[model samples]
Target: MAVPNAASHLDFVVDPEHPDAEPFYAPSKRNYPQAVKGFYRSIKWAALVATLATYYLLPFVRWNRGPGAPGQAVLLDLADRRFYFFFVEIWPQEAYYVAGLLVLAALVLFMMNALAGRVWCGYLCPQTVWTDLFFAVERRFEGDLHARRAREAKGWTFDRAWRLVAKHATWVLIAWWTGGAWVLYFSDAPTLVRALATLQAPAIAYVWIGILTFTTYALAGHMREQVCVYMCPWPRIQAALTDEWALNVTYRTDRGEPRLSLKKSHAARSRGEPAGDCVDCRQCVAVCPTGVDIRDGLQLGCIQCGLCIDACDAVMSKVGRPARLIAYDTDMNVARRAEGKPALRRLVRPRTILYAVAIAAVGSLMLWRLTTRPGGALAIAHDRNPLSVTLADGSIQNGYSALVINRDAAPRTFDLSASGVPGAKLVVEGAPSDGTRVRIQVPGDDTREVRVLLRAAAPSGAATSVPVTFTVVNETSGETATATDRFETPAAN
Candidate 1:
């Protein structure tokens, strides 16, 4: 053995003055969570029912878009490159709406983070939903935690083997149904279901179903908590976004410290000695889905599910003490209670205000743009080969490709007009015009491209390039759309 150093003796001095000394920490142990029932569980059940219903039913809901347009209420028609959501229709050119929706979603998530910890992860995430279903299957076949543990200890038997098979069969069925439901959103659900039953569905559809089935089974059944703890980036982002005032699953250390066994604590109380309310029962840890011990301080693994609170409340009721030993609380409040100070909360902080403002601003902007958008559209692409052509009539000519889009339910006439060069003659190849404007008949919900020729009577104007505007005005609605281009002429060397 080596001789003890003077530094070792100094380490024993009560409360050292050094600020950089690291505290000892132990790695967390894995917990096998037990089942419980309470108010939070009831709320979780309601959420599951609502979310799953909305997801699997909303696609089949129908909307009338008149003739020639798809009737599906919620559809992403990739073939036509259109996204239809009830009353709103998004074209490939209007991808900004999708971006706006994504921004709104992110802001909502941030607002939720500001109000509560990872409540979304525990209650609303798809990982949580599917895993809960898998767990229910496990319980139905293998029994609850106690019976499952006992069965595993007894090893494999005919009864156990058959139950295991049943369990896996049920899991696979649920996973397959999940995969099947996802494909319904892309096509007509009833039609696709019939095709699938007749084994006549597209090969690509079946391939996608198989891929989704495997992924769902592996992720929800096999991976479980590993996805939340090790794979997800949301937890880390939430950690950075969270403030001390944000509510989280917390252990009331102020009321539960100086822990002792139930019998010992009761004995100490009877003798007029100080003893904490905690019975060291470990019930809170036993009920945590992520195997986190709330008593160990606020940690990343805590999903703020409130199951531990239920477990501790049950324990407290049994012991004839007040509940809420483990409950939703804030770090600032916990610290205040520890320091014998009044609790303080600030929900209207800068971060929350910023998120709310951004969400409102983006939502309003998208709504305004959608409401005021014109029914007609125009685009012009100037020919690049020769830049400008010298016609036999001693005039400079510019060629362009013009596209006119009609976004209505009936055929509409649009007057196509161009302006830039004075005394320029305009001609549409496939249609006749009244010199200055052309009448183009555009079909309902369709776009038409036409070749346009612009001839300047002469190059006497002096400029080599000039700005040009192409306008298309719907004759019925008087709605107009304009696109800009440049008129190019040959250089005078």
Candidate 2:
């Protein structure tokens, strides 16, 4: 039998009663995050500047696309059914490219999750960035967290009333600018700006601007963290994707347990007794935007922004303890510490490998298809009402609608011909024929449709179905496109 002291060598906390062993579940309180400076804070600041600049300025950038094309660098011209991004123009038939882009975006999100937990939510998400800006405005007009708290504690005052009004006025201006910037992408920015200044812009523009302004104010100014905690699906999906190795904002209970006041901790240490480093200062909680006590364990409310880390580090520096009581750490490290072993970190996992492979594969496929896509196309549709007609001379005639698309931005002529049936002749209605072929000029960046009649001199006992080929040959470049259709005949055999 093991002695009591020998058994105590194993690292297990003995609870005299079961009351303290229940699972942790605390009702969330509203967090009024205090500002702090650290590496993560600097990163957040840089991201804010970059993202906001891109959003508000990209629509005004110019891209010269020769003549008769919209010059905006990035635009979605709904009136013309065209999406222009620099040199690439997408038409209605290329909507699959947008679907592919969405798939690529999802894969990138998963990869970010596999590598770092909710880094996108912390820094890059529009909600987070906009809320951060609104908070800054609130601080500028109302003062820091404590000042606002004091003002709220007091009764209504004229000074407070004015400050409140000023703050809201600022918020509305920002929200309006945010909404106004969005509509510029759909039309010519300079023309729209002049029209809007003269109060002559389209009614649809005003309607969209009003809708977006209201939503931005409501979501960024009022909803704030509530949007992240209860409204977003990403949190649930992130929870599912996270693994033991992924770093999350966590509390190091091993270094912070048995928390006490600073004086009591010093007294305990003087007597050569064990005392944890944390003095229970509550600085981490005070600075957490989500009001999460990271020491309790990883919680869903934490956006993994590392603000608490900055707060706790400042506290540690003032109290003469090491920093990072709160940090981006893995659960595996926690378990290892509990087991009296060194922590391990692993970022190369199967999930990350899979995401990387998918990104690369899909990217390569898109590039290959874009580079090798056909520059011209031909389509043939046979007439349904009268599939075939027997002329007075006993020759079988078939009517078809032929469409030729010229993708290049240059005027070109194409010769339409028919083959695959012996003595088959082709005639294009409303087109001039040059002896053997019907030649038609197709304007640049457009498609032309022509009615075609195919006459085949065949015996009355011929088969019911015969294969026919219609070919369109570029008169200048000799590039050819062929479409196959069936020539119907009366069953006489």
Candidate 3:
């Protein structure tokens, strides 16, 4: 919260010795965005409430996934290296899903960018929502931007001091809860909440909560627009991704230019001279979160949140002028209007089509894989150093490491057998081995790796390597999975 004192304001003095020298960066200034009410503001409020509610309350929703599995609807079971989302279970080996999800998210963001520039930053970003809430808290405690600015100019009094403290205290509380809710997704939410309340939760949980709390407070409460301006990369990305035709928060210079006072405009109009609607009021700049002046043409600072549009619309209403002088329109359209051409919108452009197609393809593929994947799986890796050994009975043996997965509600007994090798026999260490196959019992929703040895008499003569498939059959459900490896025979000298 680098709220510099008025006394600390710098004097820009030019040096006689190095006359061409200039400051590389300007000094940071405080931005006090005033509240505005209009269509866009209402939309922002709705989005804030909905996103915050989903973030804070989603962990409480429970889902029954049978015994021995967590009931939390969304959980990352680190101990078991499993991820549960309602009925969907993702094993550690299925981490590709996370990568696929990231790709899908990027495509969706691109689609949004194509539709409307930086709309995600304006409405749906966590930073914007939390910062909006924090601003509301500030306004509640310290009054709107005007009062706060006046109070600061007059120097801090006892009431102002208390208000500042109260505002920050509320911000910290909200941030703490934000962080606390995040940890609930890793474990049972209700149980964790009880543990946290009683100070019985793990130390790591408290550490994470504290870290997130501090960051949230610093970023949302203190930094605010600076995060979107100096820190975020989305603005730069949006700049590259956007075109002249992409819709953005723009000031219609044609409609609002020739800036004049209301009385001057009236006088000019009566004299049959040209006059513009704009009264040179700074309402649009006063309401922007990123402190961007949309009238200065498109800049990197604007998040396209449309608060400026709302502010301009409110100003237009008060002045009895038509609304939307500041609007979500394209720069190309603005130029077209300046050139006496009608504005045209083409939403279904090539870039947008590409993004939509990519999103749909990836989403459909993920859904199909999720729904059609097998319940059980197996894999085998054969030993290299000692590929085969000739026993006293002239039998050939090969060692292997076998991994079996059990995606079931209850424990299962799996019978392991080898095929594609004549007279081959399977033997699993530490498991019941019969003359035909080896039987191993595995717990539900788990994977086990075991040492296995296969012995089969020489087919006719010594063969170098022969393809063999190891099959594991679930005795209860009769579900089976197989993996292939080489069954080696001793080479002839």
Q: Quick one: best lDDT, which candidate?
A: 3
Better of 2 and 3 by TM-score: 3
Candidate 3: stretches off by over 4 Å: 1-27, 381-399, 417-425, 433-437, 454-470, 484-493
Ranking by TM-score: 3, 1, 2
Angstrom error of the Cα, residue 318, model 3: value is 1.8
- In terms of TM-score, how similar is model 3 to the real structure? 0.88
Cα lDDT tens digits for candidate 3, 1-493: 3656433343345454665676433455767789888899999999999999999998999998887778999898898899988878898778888899999999999888888889999999999999999989989999988788788877869988999999989999999999999999988999999999999999999999999999999999888988888889988988999987789998899998887888898899899988787877889999887788888988888888999988888888888999999899997899899999999998988998899899999999999989977667788999887888999988988899998888887888888888888888888889988856888888888888999999998766556788899889989888888899888877821
List where candidate 2 sits over 4 angstroms from the true fold: 1-31, 378-404, 414-440, 447-493
Clashing pairs in 3: none
* 376 Cα displacement, candidate 1 (Å): 1.9
Worst 10 residues of 1 by lDDT: 23-32
Model 3 local distance difference test score: 0.87
After superposing candidate 1 on the true structure, give the runs of residues whose Cα lies further than 4 Å from its correct spot. 1-32, 271-274, 381-400, 453-465, 489-493
Q: Which residue pairs in model 1 clash with each other?
A: none
Model 1, position 57, has a per-residue lDDT of 86
